[model samples]
Target chain A: MPRRVALEGSHAVSEAVRMADVDVIAAYPITPQTHIVERLAEMVANGELDAEFICVESEHSAMSAVVGAAACGARVFTCTAGQGLELMHEVLFVPSAMRLPVVAVIANRALSAPLNVWGDHSDVMAIRDCGWIQMFAENAQQAFDLTLCAYKVAERPDVLLPAMVHIDGFHVSHVVEPVLLPEEETVREFLPPSEYPFPLDPDRPVSMGCYGPPYIYTEVKKAQEVAIENSYEKVLETFKEFKDVFGREYRPVETYRVEDADMLLLMMGSYAETAMLAIDALRERGDNVGLVRLRLWRPFPAEELRNVLRGVKAVCVFERAISFGMGGPLCAEVRAALYHLPEGERPKVVSFVGGLGGRDVSVEEFEAMLRRAKERVSSDELEGFEFVGLRE
Target chain B: MRGELSWKELEVGAIVTEPGNAAEYRTGDWRSERPVRKQELCIMCGNCYIYCPEGCIVLKEGRYETDLYYCKGCGICANECPKGAIEMVEEGK
Candidate 1:
């Protein structure tokens, strides 16, 4: 039987890392993410987990250390949030480009200008095109499961790429919830030891991070794009195996109450749970409302999303991060995914940017947002985007 | 220098499977000038051998020569020679 215990989201991530039997962990402390590395440090000190816990000075050094370790055939793990991620911005591309299977857990938080340190999608969205397999977790349980699955997905021979699991900082990272911790033997069976095909060794040395001039840069990028896009199949396969072993099913685009509904609300991260409650209230009032939660961000699951939105009449996307002059990043991507649908089948996508800088997005706000989306669909003159729950 | 593999044959992430594949690249093609050694004026201080950026300077037996196939003709060896035994001459001269 699996052990069920109430664990904080960050602790759940640490426990998952421990069970994954990571050989190295290089991380710098950042808000919401600090607890994760802290717990790992304790585990190492207490001899509970045998791993090299490197205390780096900055996030850049932390990422660089993990990249070096992974290249040398070590199963490495790391965690970061907000500005720490921003500090490691340039280093983020190297691991994926080198095809090193380094797993990182991102406690998603808002970026600075106002210098906020709270939960949001701004951090992850900033590096959406960094060539890593990115996934979002709505709760503590998914955070633990996805962290383990990330290793299995990244270490696959056909999909030798770095992976990141994003948990909304403060909202998901700080929340204490009951999580079923899998046995060590089961995790070991599911995710066997990673064997890198080409690792840096003195006896058999290989040049990594070689300079690519203009002549081959385009081809290199094309190859990377194809690899990431193709890994979608491997991700699904890994999730299926995980479900069989652990009994927890995960999907790229998870839906709720959409069978008979015409209006759909789309969101990612922890806010999706709140949106479900709002959907229930609207359903009780005889309204046709449903919810669509996005789990995979990078290598965007366009096919799965298109299939889910096939018959939906209207879609209201709740975005936690704004793209300034443009609108919500999530809303823009959702619209682009649905752009190919025929005119008669396409749904009117209403964009709503909210919960930025750690601001709370209430259930009442979701209800009002849905009402606004329905009005726009009926009026046939939809507004571009709006900042929901803005004080002004 | 042309690439051996077509774009289709190229591996993802531009990984170089063979060790020391740089040896086949012939970086000497980048040279605008070449370093010529004067054996008569040579002191054999080995400064040129140490300073050569590409490590192309070779001391075989008692003779010191630059491996033109791999040298980029940076002229660093010529500049570092205390006895002026190495000279940078225009390539193909």
Candidate 2:
């Protein structure tokens, strides 16, 4: 039977991992993400979950260990944050390139300069091209739901790539919320057994991670590209299956109050909920504003985004991470996605950097950013870069 | 169009040993080289067998044997053998 539990987002993620019946859990302790692995460790020790819980030395080893296990045809999982993720940098390419369906939970946190453990999207945004399927959750419920969806989406034979579920560090990870705990049978029925196309059986041994020369390398990459792009359909299909069994609908990009609205708010992760609050308040003032929250980042929703922003006059792209010299990373990608469209049909896009180092982007501040964006749209002089609610 | 193997029968992606490598390295007759294992020094760790990259090694009676049909004379086994048990020696030397 399904039960409703009031649990923290990080705990919810751990619960989902437990419910998925993962074969291996390799993790290292890092701030804001510590509680998750700690709970998982408790579960493993108490025999509540039967999994090989490896205490890896660092996040690099954490990812590397999961890769070895997943390569040998084990359902593997791990979690990391901030510098921990940055430590796993190079190894991130191995799993997806090998088409291993390893699921990772990334508690979104800021990158360090003076060394701070706080909530932000900097860590996840940095590894945008590592060939992992990326998904963002708006709340603890979404976090729990998306983590299950990630395994289904990744393990699909046509879409055998790794997946990362991102939720803001303290904002979502540590905050307690009500999450619907689906029955074990429901999850088991939805996600089928994952086996390697060629397992590491000694009887019929096959070579993995072979060195490919230039002649065959291009074909390898072409197959990977086709696999990820083809996965968009499977992502939607899994979401539908999830809804049919579990009764929840998740789209690549979810819209909030967008119908009959002129201004669209573009953002991802937990910040979207705060933006929705601002949008609702603005709607009360008779402003035709809406929110478009991006759920899938890689195999990016290029067509879905263009469809959502098709008739909107102006768009304020709120980013939790900066790409340094190139403005916001999400903003740049969104612009590039819309660049090929006919000029007259494109939306006037502006970038806003907010919530760095876990500094709160309150509803009032979000409204202020929207006001500034609206002013830019009206005066036809909106600057490309706008830092919202900063202590300058 | 080449020596020994006709270009017509040579399929693509079939790894071929570089021609005249022994002459370039002051060694005689690269084609005759096969990996030979010193069993006394071997620990039977299977590192050579597992990392063959060509699936060319087989273990029988707790000793490693090389499958010569598909072994392209890569010498990777001799290069990576940690115990130094395997050596690339000319077949008739």
Q: How many Å off is the CA of B17 in candidate 2?
A: 20
- What is the C-alpha lDDT profile of model 1 across A342-382, one tens digit per residue? 98788888888889888998899999999988887898756
Instruction: Tell me the tens digit of each residue's lDDT in model 2 across A1-392.
Output: 67889999999999989888899999999988988899999999999889999999999999999999987789889999999999999999888777788999999889999687998889998888899999998789988899999999888866778999998999999999988999888888887778656556676555555554454566666667777888899999988988998898999999999988888889999988888999999999998999999999988999999998876788889999888887889988888888877877788888899899898999999889888888888888655688877667
The candidate scoring highest on DockQ is: 1
- Cα lDDT of candidate 2 equals 0.84
Worst 10 residues of 1 chain B by lDDT: B1-10
Best by lDDT: 1
Chain A TM-score for each of the predictions: 0.99, 0.98
In terms of lDDT, the poorest run of 10 residues in model 2 chain A is A207-216
Which pairs of residues collide in model 2? none
Report the lDDT tens digits of candidate 2 across residue range B7-85.
2332221222233322222122234688888989988888888888778798888789887756766788989899898
How big is the positional error of residue A221 in model 1, measured in Å on the Cα after superposition? 1.6
Return the TM-score for each candidate structure: 0.88, 0.82
DockQ class, candidate 1? acceptable
Candidate 2 stretches greater than 4 Å from native: B1-93
